[model samples]
Target: MSSENDWNEDLCGCMNDGGTCLYGFCCTPCLFGANAEKISEKNCCLMCCLYLVLGSVYLCWVPHYFERQKLREKYNLKSNPSCGDCPTTLLCSPCALCQEARELKARESVQRSALKANNNQPVVSQPEANSGEADHVNMRV
Candidate 1:
């Protein structure tokens, strides 16, 4: 039901979401950990530790590349001919991680909205007023 020729956001669109941009800039390991967790449906701490430890040895990119490829395939994303997972993950690790995080975040939000709509629930609930009357009640003398 999804197209395989497009990415939800451009690689350079890291600043589109301030929170994600900040997290990616300040703590990339944490961002990657969160992304990996979301993608694998695993524990965030475990993913974070794995990334941090293996990433230090330079072989971590292998796993990251595979994960990125998996995400692209799962989401029906267009493959980057010039800059595939290897180069993207190895050369520009932060940017690649940011892009993946953005994609996952967008996908989750879209799914949530779709589910809410399908359930016939308002996206935002309105508070009910008591007594169906104005707040200005007159006191009888």
Candidate 2:
């Protein structure tokens, strides 16, 4: 790892998340496309098709390589390879995709928890607000 932050999760740590790992393993194309879509790549289906076709020829690593680089750039993460992400994607495509999915999942949960925490607290100290309905808008009926 360089001065940049390491990836929050390990590549082989894919087993830590069963559903995502299974998804990455069984539907590698979908996983790749989805990861690309999350990082703002347009045409998720196109990406899926690309992965399908390229993967058949064992060249899917090409797109995954660039996608990984984009992800690294997006999050300021350190690339593990001195040669860059190419080798990692070339050698460990499934693990790479699983890692991406887990990263997205983990970040999403963290964000949701953060929002929940924030919503639970008041931004400023203030008197309780009263609904005037209790006083002037009463109906005796």
lDDT of each: 0.81, 0.86
lDDT by residue (tens digit), candidate 2, 39-136: 76657899999999998899999989888888888778887865457878998899989988888787778989999999999779767557775555
True lDDT of residue 86, candidate 2? 83
Q: lDDT: which candidate is best?
A: 2
Report the C-alpha lDDT of model 1 over 1-141, residue by residue, as the tens digit.
766668888778888887888898788778878888888776777777877888889766776787788888778789888888888888887888889999998899999999888899546878776763434453321
Candidate 1's C-alpha runs over 4 A off are: 1-3, 121-141
Least lDDT summed over 10 consecutive residues: which range in candidate 1? Answer: 132-141
